[model samples]
Target chain A: DVKVTQSSRYLVKRTGEKVFLECVQDMDHENMFWYRQDPGLGLRLIYFSYDVKMKEKGDIPEGYSVSREKKERFSLILESASTNQTSMYLCASGQFKEQYFGPGTRLTVT
Target chain B: AQSVAQPEDQVNVAEGNPLTVKCTYSVSGNPYLFWYVQYPNRGLQFLLKYITGDNLVKGSYGFEAEFNKSQTSFHLKKPSALVSDSALYFCAVSPASGGSYIPTFGRGTSLIVHP
Candidate 1:
């Protein structure tokens, strides 16, 4: 079975603080993604990495950046967190047909 | 751009009854469709996917989805619903040919199974 693990299951940050969410996959998949899920917006892509040091902006990439220094790990960085940035963040890794997701990190900014 | 649409926001059904959650997709090339389920406060779980060959693909938890090329739809179905089956269902789509492999997800449908 494929396992995708996130660094944190829940987090709370104050406004204007920097935040990082990490994800690691054991399947050695080539593609990794970061998404923020909202009630009505579904899972909107924030950023994705196809290979090490290669990143692409998804539909909503503002105020967020990604790092893929290694194949097994992907990290999402928030430049400065705000209340609006609070959301359920999910990380996924896969090749083509199927993608496996992590448990997700619920971030709350106050 | 490729996208997926789940028409219903909520579907209510009695336990042991049949249930359907509608999903339609738009893509420039052939579509790779998928269904995912999310329990409360949990990440999404892959229910099934339609890649090629067969139009009807069966998945985990006694769920299945039919891929209709003409209608551009991939609706999810279950023979009999259970109280535990209630959750948020998402439909996703990606282009079979040229494009990013990342799948675009629908807004999601909440399934309610009443006893």
Candidate 2:
């Protein structure tokens, strides 16, 4: 079975603080993605990495960056977090057909 | 640009009754459609996907989806609904032949099963 694990299940941060959300997949998949889920927005892609050091901006990539220094790990970085950035962050890894997602991190910014 | 739409914001059904969640997609070429369910405070779980071959794709937890090419729809269905099946369902679509495989997700439809 494929396993995708996230660093934190829940996190709270102050406004303008830097935040990092980590995701690791054991399936050795080539593609990893970051997304934020809101009530009415479903899941909006923030960033994705196809290969090591190769990153692309998804639909909503503002105020967020991604790092893929290794194949198994993908990290989402908020350079300076704001209250509006609070969301349920999800990470997924997959090949071409389907994606396996992590448990997700609920982020709350105050 | 590829896009997915879930027409219903919520679907209510009695337990043990048949249930269906509507999903439609728009893409330039052939589409790879998918259905995923998210429990409260949890990440999305892959229910099923329609890539090729069979138009009807069965997946985990007795869930299935039919891929209608002519209608451009992939609606999730279950023979008999359960209370546990209550969750947020999302439909996604990606172009079959594309450099980027990032799928566009629908706004999602909340499923509530009443006893």
Candidate 3:
């Protein structure tokens, strides 16, 4: 079975703090994606990595960066967290058409 | 670019009754459409996909979707609704031939099953 695990299920950070959300997949899929899901907005892509060290900005990548140093792990970094950055972040990994998702991390910035 | 749309924000149905959640897409090439369901505070789970061959594809949890090329729609359906089926349903689309394999998701439709 394909397993995608996120580092944290819930996180709280103060404003102007740095935040990191980690995701790891056991399937070794070639693609990893980071998305923030909001009410009514659905899942908006923040960043995606096709291969190690290769990253592309999705629809909304502002204030966020991604790292893919290895095939199994993908990390999302917030330069400086703000209250507006609070969201439920999801990570997915897949190849071709099918993607598997992690449980998701709900980040709250105060 | 590929895009998907779920026309209705929410759909309400009674338990044991038939339910349908509408989804439409716009893509340049043949579309690889999918249906995913998200329970409260959980990630989305793949339900079904319409890649090729059969226009009607069955998936997990007794969910099925029909791919209508002419109408550019892939609506999700269930024979009998259940209270457990209440969740947020999202439709996604990806171009089969060219472009990236990353699928674009719709805003999603909230399904409510009343007893």
Please provide, for model 1 over A1-110, each residue's C-alpha lDDT reduced to its tens digit, 9 standing for 90 to 100.
99999999999999999999999999989899999999988999999999999999999999999999999999999999999999999999998758899999999999
**Candidate 2 - CAPRI tier?**
high
lDDT of 2 by residue, B1-115 (tens): 8888899999999999999999999998999999999999999999899888999999999999999999999999999999999999999998899645788899999999999
* Candidate with more favorable, higher lDDT: 2 or 3: 3
Q: What is each candidate's DockQ, to 2 decimals?
A: 0.83, 0.83, 0.87
Query: How high is each candidate's TM-score?
Result: 0.98, 0.98, 0.99
Top candidate, metric DockQ: 3
lDDT per residue, candidate 3, B1-115, as tens digits? 7889899999999999999999999999799999999999999898989889989999999999999999999999999999999999999999999788889999999999999
Per-residue C-alpha lDDT of model 1 across residues B1-115, encoded as one tens digit per residue: 8888898999999999999999999998898899999999999999999989999999999999999999999999999999999999999998888877789899999999999
Candidate 3 lDDT score at position B26 = 98
DockQ of 3: 0.87
Single out the weakest 10-residue window by summed lDDT for candidate 2 chain B.
Answer: B94-103
Instruction: Say what the interface RMSD of candidate 3 is.
Output: 0.6
**Candidate 2, TM-score of its B chain:** 0.98
